[model samples]
Target: MTASPPPADDLSPPPSCPDAAAPAPAQALQRLKVAPAEQPLSAAQKKFNRLLARVNSLERQLEQLQQSADALRAPHLQRMDALRQRMAQAQRAMAQLLHARLQRPGLTAAQQRAVRALLRDLVHAVPPSPQPEPEWAALRAAYPRPVPAAPSPEALQQLLDVLSAASGETLELSDLEDAGSPEALIEALAERLHAQDEARRAAAAERRARRKTTARQAEAQAQAQDARSALRGIYRQLASSLHPDREPDPAERERKHALMSQANTAHERGDLLALLRLQLAAEQVDEAAMARLGDARLQSLCLLLQRQVGTLDRELAEAEARLAHELGVQVRAADPRRLLEADLQALQDELQNLAEGMEHDVHALQDDDKALKAWLREQARLAREHERAAREMTGFGFQF
Candidate 1:
C-alpha cells in the first residue's frame, strides 16, 4: 500500500487519530462568538439598560447647563459691574451735594427739614465708616436726634421676631446689637441665616448618612453576599485579563494598562454599569452574557443604576438652581437662554432710567430752590401715605 502512494487530494486522517481532526485555533475562537440577535433581553436587563441611559442623559444635561451658564454669566457680570459703578458715582455726587446744602447758613425750618431728610437717605445708602464723619457730631447736635434713624429698636425687634418665626428659634434684640449699625445688623442677620441654613444641611446630611448605614446593615442581612460576590467576580475577571505585567507585547501591554486603570476605578467606586461597559469594551462579555446575569446580580445592578440616576438628577437640579439664582430669573426648562436675555434687558433699562432720574434730581436741586421745595413736599406726602398704609396693614407704626 505505501509503495502505491496515495492520491494528492486524499488528506483524511485515520478515525482513531482524534487530535489530527481538531479545528485550527482561529476557527475555535470563531465558535465562541454568539450572534447578539440570538438573545432577547429580559425585563430586568431592559430596566437596567434604561436606567443607565437615563444617568448618561442627565450627566450630559448637567455638563451642557454648566457651559451655557458660564457663557451667559461672563458678559452679564461685566455689564452689571459697569452699571453698578455708574450708580455708585452718582450716589457719591448726590451725597456730597446734600452735605454741602446742610452746611449753608440762613435756612428756614422747612428747608432744613428737607435737607436733613435727603442727608438721612444718603447716610443710610452709604456704608458705615470705621471712624465717624467730621459733620456727624455737628449734624447730631443740630438735629437733636439720629438723622438716619434706620433699624431702630422697634425695627430691630420686629426683624428679630420675623427671623425667629421663620427659623423656629427665639431671637432677642441683643443678638444683633453687636453689629452697631443698620447695615451691619442686616449683614449680621444674613450671616445668621446662612449659618442656620448650613446647620440644617449638615443635619440633613447626617440623617442621610445614618439611613445609608442602616440600609447597608439591612443589605448585609439579606443579599449583600451575592451582590458583593457578583461585583468581585467581574473585577477579578477584568484584573486577570487586563494584567499589563502578564502581557509580553509592549503596545498591547500599554493599551491594557489604561483599561486596567479604568477597571480599578470602577471596582473601587462599586460602579456596576461602568464595569459592565469595560467588560464589553474588552470583549470579555457580550450583550448575551449581560442579559443572562443571575437574578440577584441583575437586581443589584439595576438598583445601583437607579441610584446613579437619582444622584445625577439632584446634581442637575442644583446646577440649574444656581444658574437661576445668578441670573436673577426663574429658569424654565424650555428656552432658559431667552428668558435670561429678556430679564437682563429689562434690568439694563431699569438701570438706565435710574441713572437718568438721578441726573435730573441733581440738576433740579442744584438749579432751583422752588424745585427742591416742591420735591420735598411730594416726598412728605408720599411718606404720609406710606405711614398710613403701614398703619392699616399692621395697626402699628412698624417701619419696614
Candidate 2:
C-alpha cells in the first residue's frame, strides 16, 4: 500500500471512511472565524459620552418642566384674575365708606386726617371719574394732593455717574435736566440706554467682523467645519438606511418616513446628538462604534454637545425666570412644580385673609363710631410715623 501511495495532488483519503473527509488542520483553522477585539474608550472619548448622557438627561428634564409649567399656567392665571376682581370690589367698598364718612358732620380732626389718608391710598384703587361729583371736588379742594419732591441734584448726579460708568460714556446732569419728573427721567434714561446698547452692539459686530478674518477665526472655522462634517456624516448614514423609498413594506416605509423627517430636522438644526440617536435607532451605528470614533471626530462632537448644553442651560434659566415672573414667586430649581403649587396656595390664602379683613373693616366702620374713632386715631399715628420715615429717607438723599 505504501508503494501504491497516491500522488501529492491526490492526497485525499477515499470517501468510504467518515474520517477521510475531515478537514485538514489549516482548513479547519480557516473555517473558525475570530472576532476582532473592541477598542476601549480613551479619556476624551469617555468624557464625550458623559457629556452626551448629560445632554440627553437635560433635554428630558426641560421638556417635562415646560409641560408642567404649561399645564399650571392657565389655572394660575384664572385664579389670579378672580382674586384681583374680588380685591377690586373690596377696595371700592372701603373707598365708598371712607368717602361717606368724610361727608358726615362733626368729624374730629384725627378722624378727618385718617379719612384723607385712606382716600390718598385709594387713588390707584378707585377708578377716576371723568366728571367729578360736587362733594368729591370740594373734598379735593380742602385737602389738595401733595406734590412729590423732585430728585435731589446729588441723587441725579449719582445716577448720571453710575450710568456713565456702566455705558462707558460721560453723562452730565445738564444732559437730562429737561427730565424733571421721575417718570420723565426714567423715559430719558431708557432712551440713553437704548442708544448705548445700539452703540455697543455695533462695536461688537465690527469686532466680530475683524475677528472673522484672523488666523484664530480661521482655526475656529476649520473646527466648525469638522464638527459639521461629523454631524453630516451621521445624518447621511441615517438617511441612507432609513429612506422610505428603499423600504418595500407599507408599515416599514411609514416608519422610515417618520425617522427620515426627524433626521432631516435634526440635520437642519445642527443637532448632532439627535442625528446620532437616529443612527442608533436605525441600527446604523452602535455604542461600540461611537466609542471607536477618531479623536478629532470625537472632539468635534464634544464641542457641539458642549454648545448644546450651554443653550439648554440658558433655555432652562429663561424658562424658570418666566415662570417665576408669571407666578409672582421665586421658583425653586430642585422641585419647581411643588414650590409653585405651594406658593400659589399661600397667595390664595393671603388674598382670602385680605378680603375677610376688608369686609370686617367695612362692618366695623359703618356700625360703631367709638371703635371707628379709635381705629382712626391709630391710623393717624401710623401715618405720622410713615411721614417721619419718608422725611428721614429724603434727608439721606433717597427719592420716592
Steric collisions counted per model: 0, 0
Question: Against the unseen true structure, what C-alpha lDDT does each candidate score?
Answer: 0.65, 0.69
TM-score of each predicted structure versus truth: 0.57, 0.72
Which portions of model 2 show Cα errors greater than 4 Å? 1-40, 126-174, 177-219, 243-254, 377-400
RMSD of 1: 12.8
Could you tell me how far off, in angstroms, the CA of residue 48 lies in candidate 1 after the best superposition? 1.9
Residue-pair clashes, model 2 = 0
Candidate 1 has what TM-score?
A: 0.57
The model with the greatest TM-score is 2
Q: TM-score of predicted model 2?
A: 0.72
